[model samples]
Target: MATPAADLANWIPRLLATWRAARRTQRRGGPRPPLDALLPDELREVAAAVTRLSTGLTRERELAGARYLDDERLLGAYLLFYWPISYLQARGVLSELPRLPRTVLDLGSGPGPLAFAALDAGAVAVTACDRAKQALTAARDLARLAGARLTTRDWNPTQGTPLASLTGGTPPDLITLGHVINELWKGEGAEEKRAALLESAARALAPGGSLVVIEPALRDTSRGLLRVRDLLVSRGFAVRAPCLFRGACPALLKESDWCHAERAIDPPPLVAQIGKAAGLRKEAVKMSYLVLAPPGEPWAAPPPGVVLRIVSEPLAGKGRLRYMGCGPDGRKGLALQEKHVGDANRRFETLKRGDVVALEGTEPRGDGLALGAGSRVTVLAEAGRPVPMPVDGQA
Candidate 1:
């Protein structure tokens, strides 16, 4: 039998190596390298660590019926990259804008990443508020380092009231609700919190101000998302087209699902698009961004096209792979491209693995017609492999 000392000796080097790899990946301006790249001997141990962290997160939320601000630490090494990854998706809309907000309010700004994003986008004032003092402290320290001012508040979702203390006794020019809304809706105190947040954001929004609420698109039936979406719409906010949050759907895409043991990765090009798909145009003060708006403004609209599921053909051509996929509307075809590209864009090349071809043409070839040429599509990967359909069900 292996003695404890022997086991420790055997694992320490691998553990240290993995940790160093994670740290390096964090600082490299990208996402955590695929979980597999960690040394194989260390993978099982790291996987266990990931499982423990995931379990802790779920269990704490399930037990407490609310989020623990400290749990945000689970994202410590990763939070750095997560911001830029998200920014890449939103930049398309933001970059075309003529200006950024002079004053910005980031609700539930744990660690203040969003606050900094707003500032980087040229906001004059970035006020980040969160209920967790520890999280606020971290945010403050970072803000100080960046030479940006931060105002923290004791705003709890359960409070069901605005942090009236820091509303400046007036509305804010821009407000951002990032990831905190869903946390507010997970249990007994949810409805009140949701109502309060919605009402507060609406009432405190400057006449021509905009409110951006972003969250992971993890809800089934888009119920929680739709509730807030509808509430905003009813309050006169318009829904923007192409659900802003589009990307890979994790195995835990649903609210209560949990994974056990070593399961296959849900696969890629797994791109989970998560962002605010719609922003209400406050019309009066006249934001210049409205000029670049795509036809419909402040309206509830679905994304332009359906997601396409692509199955990997690792045996295909040199330096490339073969893929077969179907749109969310159920049209199927084959895609020839690098396995790394996670979404369906015009750049994907034309090739074949069978009858399916990545040629320039409509899907379903006039027979099923799910997606037309030029439709925006996402390609999700499963267990590091791509498939042609959403195995978990419709996306």
Candidate 2:
């Protein structure tokens, strides 16, 4: 029942303590100042390192899958800043799962942010797997400080390692690969290889379990995830959330456009300070994620009536409210003129990127559908909440 934000409230200071302890070269006997009260110079230093780390991971592509986290300064920046973001993103995606996961396996888990996130979100058993030893050690240290049980393993999928090696011979209810799928198997036929890895994970899933994939919101990464999604869907896998178009991904019809989701956040104080100094935006969390059921499982039936998942933020126009929605019918433009906006359909004016909306009295217009004054709009699900399964038109 604990929301990611509510649970993360307990993790912020423990993360700070672990990060501070990691920086110590010698044990000091006396009382030392709290690391939460970072000095101006210290903040500036970490911010500069954060800027560099962000560049290498996002823009430069120099540190995408590298051992950047082994470096103390960059690792500190990650633990203090990016770790919270990953935790929030993982928790948000987990919230959309149809069934709460009892056990989780977090692949390529640097410092085990997603691993800890799974624990905080109610997963009883979790294993953080990665190839980097320092990152795994950091994860262990944080677990020690939080008094939470965590498991860590050395995992390198590039060597063609099967997930069974890390599963302790028992499949987890949920397996998460956060921001690490795109970094694997570079060059030609990479999409096929990624799909293969996902297929293996899907085969290893417990009955009614889910394999959750979270990637960065960058254009290339998101498109890559879409391609992998298409491959799995082609392989007869069923997506549990974030996709109503059960066929090929419509977002990949174009080269420039990609799909992603975003949600507003009240970041921790230290994260805000680090963001201010690093020149990064921490106000809203953004990522491309997918939750897929194993083969033979069917997609959840759409609630009665015309339902569509709002897949875009508000598109700018002079007098019309416009968004792109993907549903069983396919992806199409959804428009509502400002003049036609009334009490019934006013909620459509401020829909988020991931909100699932149900409509009544909609008419086909341009490429999609239009809402008139008589139209009624109901939000079936918020950005992170799970969409309810309707029975006899009742949710």
Using TM-score as the measure, which candidate wins? Answer: 2
lDDT to native, each model: 0.42, 0.88
lDDT of 2 by residue, 262-376 (tens): 9999998888988998889799999999999977887777788889999998996989989999988989899899999999999998899999999999999978998899999
In terms of lDDT, the best-performing candidate is 2
Model 2 clash pairs are none
Q: What are the RMSDs of all candidates, in order?
A: 15.3, 2.2
Q: CA shift at 271, candidate 1, in angstroms? A: 17
Off by over 4 Å in 1: 1-53, 56-67, 71-99, 161-164, 187-196, 221-223, 241-395
Each prediction's TM-score versus the true structure: 0.49, 0.95
For candidate 1, give the lDDT: 0.42
**Number of residue pairs clashing in candidate 2, backbone atoms closer than 3 angstroms, sequence gap of 3 or more or interchain:** 0
Please give, for residues 1-395, the per-residue lDDT of candidate 1 as tens digits.
33222322332233233335334233445455443134333333434433444344344434222444454333332232233333332332233232456677778877665666666656777678877666676677656545577777767656644545667775666677665666665655564457457656756766545566555433331345445454444454443222222222222234663111111111111111111111111111100011111112333222234443332222356755334443334323343345434344434442211111223334544333333344343323222121232212233
